[model samples]
Target: MSPDLLLNQENALPWTERLNFARDIARGMEYLHERNIYHRDLTSRNCLLRELPNNSRQAVVADFGLARVVQVEPNTQPDSPRKMSVVGSAYWMAPEMMRGEVYNKKVDVFSFGITLCEMIARVHADPDDLPRTNSFGLDVEHFRQKCEDCPPAFLQLAERCCDLDPSVRPWFSDIVSITTAIIQELDSAPNGKYDITSRGSSIRRRQ
Candidate 1:
């Protein structure tokens, strides 16, 4: 299931399930980053999920049409490799990318943050529902407001992923680390369900 359809079908997923989704994505991104590949367009729509036997869905990172291979310079950090082309969905594009500045693999981290926002807020990152554009950019304040009721740790990870400065953003491995912890906590919880009460509209979950 695509995340948009998943959210539309169930309104909102439980926190544990959402954490699982994020962890899956983080692991996927981590794998790609390890190979010096960047999924330039890492959005909810690009991720696919396969249903499991026990009322669970396993996320698979798909849609690599916009993916690029980073050409690392000798003795340079992986994130230091720069690319000039401006590509990827606008809603999830990093701030540096929107500015048409040279960007690196960290841009994917930014997109992952936006995808995480979608899972938490049950909303797409694009406020205007417009297609990706170099002239367009995200409103971070609005996004943060939409993330109300989201776990603080996850929200903080989102903030770090979407940081304006590419150097300040964490690597995909770091994301996998944090999400792994969150997933473990959730799995150890009662019935793997967190006591999350919706803050706004009723969040209908799938049985």
Candidate 2:
């Protein structure tokens, strides 16, 4: 398999690089969710970035080796039976995953959350200087610092993606909404000084 283009560290890239990367990832995950597919093994290595016809970069979620078709039941038992193997990166796996419990689409959400944080950090951070953490792990303060001055809408979305409880976390459709909103805000304010309260209002409006 080819290496993830976004993870390449040949040189530094602009903030837009990171934003576009995140957007592509969200889109790919949205597609998977629509098909009731859950990529149990989501990591930076599994996401590959390719240039669009317009010369913009887009992310493609790959490596479906651990993916499974999950049913969205109204009520799923925590101890339900699972057919797939229990294998995934430690840092990106959800808490329930660590407990060896059966999970659903929410597991992908948890991994996507970690991937977002990593992409944000990679935009401007030196990999060597980053805190020593596993692939699916994150340093919240470090993420906040790297994204300092980023629109609150984006920050909140990242936080929501990494929320402890998968039940409360937004689905891929909601993630698309948040990411779209953030992109719109960024386009309007190129300087990146966003209205936190106003952005919060927009998010609440969606909810």
- TM-score winner among the candidates? 1
lDDT of 2 by residue, 1-207 (tens): 133433455544444455666777878888987887878888777887777899866778898988877775668653244545577776667656767776667778877877776665444122344332343334566667765655566667767877666677788888877777767765555344543333222222211
Question: Per-residue lDDT for 84-186 in model 1, tens only?
Answer: 7889897888878878888888889889877877777776566553223343434556665765556667778877876777777888788888888876765
Q: Give the 10-residue window scoring lowest on summed lDDT in candidate 1.
A: 197-206
Judge candidate 2 against the unseen true structure and give its global Cα lDDT, from 0 to 1: 0.64
Worst 10 residues of 2 by lDDT: 198-207
Residue-level error in angstroms, candidate 2, position 34: 1.9
Clashing pairs in 1: 90-132
- The alpha-carbon lDDT assigned to residue 98 of candidate 2 equals 66
- Relative to the true structure, candidate 1 reaches a TM of 0.80
